[model samples]
Target: MRFSLRSCLASLLLAAGCSAHALAPRSPGDLCGFTEGRTVLLGNLVFMMAGKTTIQDGHNEAYVKQLYWVDLNTTFNVEGAIPPNVLHSTDIPSSAPYESGGAFFAAGNTVFIYAGLMGNSRYDWMWSYNAKDGTWSRAQVDGGKLNVDHRFAGLSAVAPESNLSFFTGGWDKPITGTVVFNATDAADTKWTNVTRVEGDDAVGSPRIANGGMDYLRLGKQGVLVAFGGYDISKNGTNQTETDHDLRPMDKINVFDIDSSTWYEIEATGEIPEARSAFCTAVSAAPDDSSFQVHMYGGRSRFRENATSYDDLYILTVPSFRWIRAPTTGLIPWTEDGVGRDSHKCVSWKDGEMVVFGGTPRKDDKVQKGCSRNYPPIRVLDTSKLQWQKQFERTTKYTVPRIVSDIVGGDETGKATLKEPEGGWANSKLQSIFSQTVARRPDITEVPIPPEPTDPPKSTIPGEEPNSSNTGAIAGGVVGGVLGVAIIAGIIFFLRRRNKKKNDNSFAAATPAAPPAPPSMYPDQQQIPMDSKDDAYMQLPGELHGQTAVPPRYELDSPIQSRNRTVFELDSSARER
Candidate 1:
């Protein structure tokens, strides 16, 4: 098996417990402003509260039980009890099955809580709480018609520059649209249904069980994004693949408010495996480039004692990658505490995503709430990706087992609960457990770069020339013609020259022929006489450079005479 370089490195990191999910301790510098396992700091004091969710509306702190105003910049001593006044009676919507309700926003001093689901019934009324006057007023649904019967599955609100509130996502029933309401001007309450995505693949299916969460403004450059929720059919019992379709959606459907269209982005990497009824929070660093969306503990696999994970993940925008966050060495809960689900998550200052107020494990036989429960307030820092236990210092509250419609804190500049500006109440926050009136801090917003509409240009190398290139036909023909002509000229010259120097010259250079042939018979042949009789002698230079020659044999000797006589006798016999 060939392992990639990346896989090897990942394995090494995991082995060393240096990975994001591990409980290894981080360095001191990594802790920055907050320490590991520290309480959540609101303005100056740290809160340890459970069972109740909180948000800021201006100078007023709104919870399920009461509404109060506090100077967020100062510390509240037990002696100096801040004035607490009840907003909703314990019996009014009395233990409304809908634990999730209340939407908080500061519009020129007025904080409004619109129709949140009261138990199973969808509340048609809007309740307005004024921070400046410290009073509550009921808001009218301008169209004279509101869906009171069908509880909204998910609701999102954004305060555009116009100070108008736009809510979208039809929940509970199959309402495929959005509504725009102007709380500042009562008459401007108008519900305009936006277009829904067309298909059996619509994300709006199995609406009842799944809750909604997202950013209000949908555009390419929009800072907000929406994600996971519970789906009854999909996450519910007797769920066939087709019967339940919403528990874990692979596609993160985004609504481009600017284009008024829906875009589905596919998620990849070591992302949290498919699960629903989870929570998300954002952490914006001093340098905006470090901004991230963090997903924390959730129920992925349902069981009788199915533990909610303490795993933390951060989605880095712009690059669009999910990175495991570094942890500050803290455990999720004591070994004895029970695992949790259906919780509220919010971000605190110093780069922490504080999750608080969730319900207990649901039993199949008894479906209302779980018997074994957990601490109400648990703060998780995405930067650290660990849970800090400060339940002792915060409010002591138990599980409120329902989705909170409004979860935002005061962001206004004032000191009164007048502006729950930053914390859980930022416009970007989906629904949470409660609402309040403290100044909310400004969450660092990330602006997405515009998508490129044009296609990328090719970067491949083009064809080039080397030594072999030439005009093939012309070059070959020209070379062949020149070669033939040169050969012909040489051949013709050689033939002419050879004819001029022919055989006539050969005869002149020949020696004279012998005068006559010798006669064949010995009697007819003339024999030369001895030198004394003929008187023939050698002349000077007659034979060039010749010396006097001696006769080859002696005239008479025993062996020679005998050999010659025998040879003569043999010749005479042959002749006869």
Candidate 2:
């Protein structure tokens, strides 16, 4: 067998092909109906805000302002008893729908839903949902009128220790500033417009909306990092112009809460393309020493031909480094034509990230078509960079009654509901909302095995015997053939010499030849006077008219002997 470079490369490619399939994304099934809603992670539950309820509705689809949740600690069979773990509330207030441009964040035991479009009008009302009481309350803002230009504003909790929540940069009329809301004291909240300082040259603050923003504390200083959103600042008209078009901003904006200074940082290393309406979350790095901002799918642009990404990326804090996350599993939409944008994602326990409902980017011809089918809820393990499809429900449940219908009164008013036919304790809805925390065993990091090393090279000469043995075998065969040819040539030469000697003896015993006839020209036969005596000797009659030349002989040369042996071998081979 012969080894070749091409053969080696081909083998490597074949191995790589097998590896790629092993790393391919996968899905268990659809979790629920597609939604373009907000999501928050609390304990083991992922609470989804308002979203669409169908899979294939065109432009006429309606949004569901209801609250739904899935418990991560328990894996329920989709066909089994409607898992009490996965359920929704039919009693949500109608004024707050978790609509597009709305912001939701969790602080301590309570979740806050801030400024977003309720119906056609944008509202700055801040609503809070108490997890302990399972009730919602509206907060009153004292700083003038609550800024209503907060659609798609970037919102983040000021710090884990503080009750302050910060809202920055939004549109319909994009606000170029930051607003702070104190959950402890609603009257203490205020908004600060980002102002340009004289003689200070830096990248200007971004006027963006629908971008992902989060707060991180670096060395006791709180920093707000915002990335990828729609920017309408370049439009020549005012923010109210209906003809203004939105474009994705590629630069990342960071604000220092302590210094009140802003700096724009250019990201490097597999930076994601400009996108908006994407979901983002903060997770611990693989080393668990620092944190990284993990961002998932979003719309690439705001055009009719805009495409949604199913990729993932993470930006390391402090260093401001961008790393494209290595992901393996059934990627959403590759097999189902369902991509995600304007969705919500949250960091789960054990370095896991959960992605919930979002606007399903479909292939329909309608502009921004929303799929009626619910996209599967995907959980990604950051340590392993692997995605698992946990829940997917095929059968769409009946749309639950709204608060108004349940109360049999006006939609604007709060409704108190009597327990259904069964007592409150026996109702499945009660079990769903009961304040039970689903907890799982802590997931410890698995140690990775070290790669193997090649065996040491042989030190002794010819210790690798395969090649040496092949060479020896070839040399021995050639020497044997040469020895045989030499032996055969000696035998033939001796036999021929003996026959010649016998013929010579016989010729000497035979009769002598007759004298030559008299020359026709006797004068021409006389020897020349200038010739030597030996040259004038008589010649045989057969050689009288011919000139004789001496024969050349090659003698006693090893090269000649070797050449003779090879020639004889070749001749013998031909005859055989």
Candidate 3:
């Protein structure tokens, strides 16, 4: 091994008490490096957990079990400004290995990742990432009595108001086992396996995997609308047996958090085709009249042919209609048609949806000239119903036109057509929505709100009239939120750098030897990437008795790996 002069100089600077961060070449805001996985957006910051990122190229990849965040405050998924920043963590991999395909949720200022594949094995444990201090720790799930083994391809969504997170419908489990956790008070947070909470039967589905779920708050009722995924082949015992069938987009389930019950409803309009291993983002009406769930890029595993998708579907609540949104813009999607799966989508502010991390389906041929080398984020303006290249700081949220036609809103997405007297759906389930949702026409909310202050501007390469060039520099652009934030953004960046230099609390994780690298690219759907991966996870019964700690891996090149493996949970050290 040889040390370059640059490395020697960096070492010397460190010895002379120079800041390692200051010596390292980085962007002005100290933007983070990008990694794909289930990412969480708390306001303007996007947090990413364990997933696969190309260390060198597409073929040379490593499984990451670390926490990374990117500042979207000053960026709108633009090319130059936003990048992943290492939030600095205690060892998170040594205790919880394997990466991605788990159920990730955010409540309060914490991010919770549950049941990701660890090594070849999996765990049913719940891991939380603290936003204040970048660190990872596991919660004592169900007071350590619940004995569900580690599983992947699951779905999770958090209701921040209630401080509750729920997980359900992964592999093997046919939509059973709904684990709920309340992190309102992190120090003594509680986890409840809704399946075993009482003797009652939990919500059931056809062994769904890689589905899309997002929360919509209506008054006191917080509902998670989950739909579309692979329906694994199951037996009488509800155990996943063989391959799978793509679940129909029409087969939707609405989990009402307040009632702890699920309502099965079919949506109308131009419905989307059946698909799975997809992601979802939700933008709701301020008055809770409706929620537009933007479902994007997913794949379907049929018999022989594995197909990928790049279309957008908006599912509107109350009206319960599925509007197959158009993808006619110059850049309709980020990855072309290369089968987006296991990715994550979060609503940015009230206007756009930001997508991150996802591996293309194995059979889908590689993209034309593009890869993850560029920005790994995709922004979609759900209201405008168009894909965009960059985010604009809009003063308000807009409802999509077709959605407003049914649900009715006062804003830009306001209904163009008058809603019928009885509303969209029939009487069968009308009570559910009527009781929970604010109806149109007579509904006290705004009838037709004002349009955006300016004609909404985007930066797509070949976008039409209102669009501008993607090459437009971030600093030069004015109006909306950034209209006069040059000095403020600058001040924020300086304060961030200053804090990093003075803060000694983040000095805990310094490793002597790097961990090993994970070579296999595990599918979130848990399809046998290889026979070894399949066999290693085939051990029958639930993991009982003592908790099994997963073996951690490092990058094949330690230079890129997160050296630390253990992180102290903010609350307790007991790993239950």
Best lDDT goes to which candidate? Answer: 3
Considering every candidate listed, which one attains the maximal TM-score?
A: 3
The lDDT-based order of candidates, best leading, equals 3, 2, 1
- The CA-based lDDT of model 2 is what? 0.45
- In angstroms, give how far residue 526 of model 3 lies from its true place: 44
Q: Lowest summed lDDT over 10 consecutive residues: which window, candidate 2?
A: 566-575
In model 2, what lDDT does residue 358 have? 58
TM-score on alpha carbons, each prediction: 0.45, 0.53, 0.62
lDDT of 1 by residue, 1-576 (tens): 123433443343334322212221111111001000111122222222111322211111112233222222221111111111100111112232222332333244444444344434444455554433344566555553443433333444344233445444433443445554554454344444455565332343223233334342212333335555444433346332213333444345544444344444454444555554455665443323223566665544333233445556655332334555545645544444333444545554434555544433322110121111133345553433545532111221111111011111111111112112232222322211122212233322222122235422211111212225345534644655454445444444554576775433221333342232111111222322211121111110111111112212111111211112110001001000
Question: TM-score of model 1 relative to the true fold?
Answer: 0.45
lDDT of each: 0.33, 0.45, 0.50
Q: Ten-residue segment with the worst summed lDDT in candidate 1?
A: 567-576
Candidate 3 matches the true fold with a TM-score of 0.62
How many backbone clashes are present in model 2?
20
lDDT of 2 by residue, 1-576 (tens): 113333443344444444333332212111233354556554444665545433221112235445655544444322111212234343456566545455555554456676555534434455667553466787555554444523543444434334446766655454555666555443343334455532233445556656778765442245677877656466523222122344433366766555555566555556687766677777532222234678887765433355667778877543455667657764555444445665667665435666665555454111232221233356665555666544321111111122223323232222233222223322322322222112223332221112125422211111112344666655755665455445444544554576664332221233343332211211223322211111111110111111012222211111211112110001001101
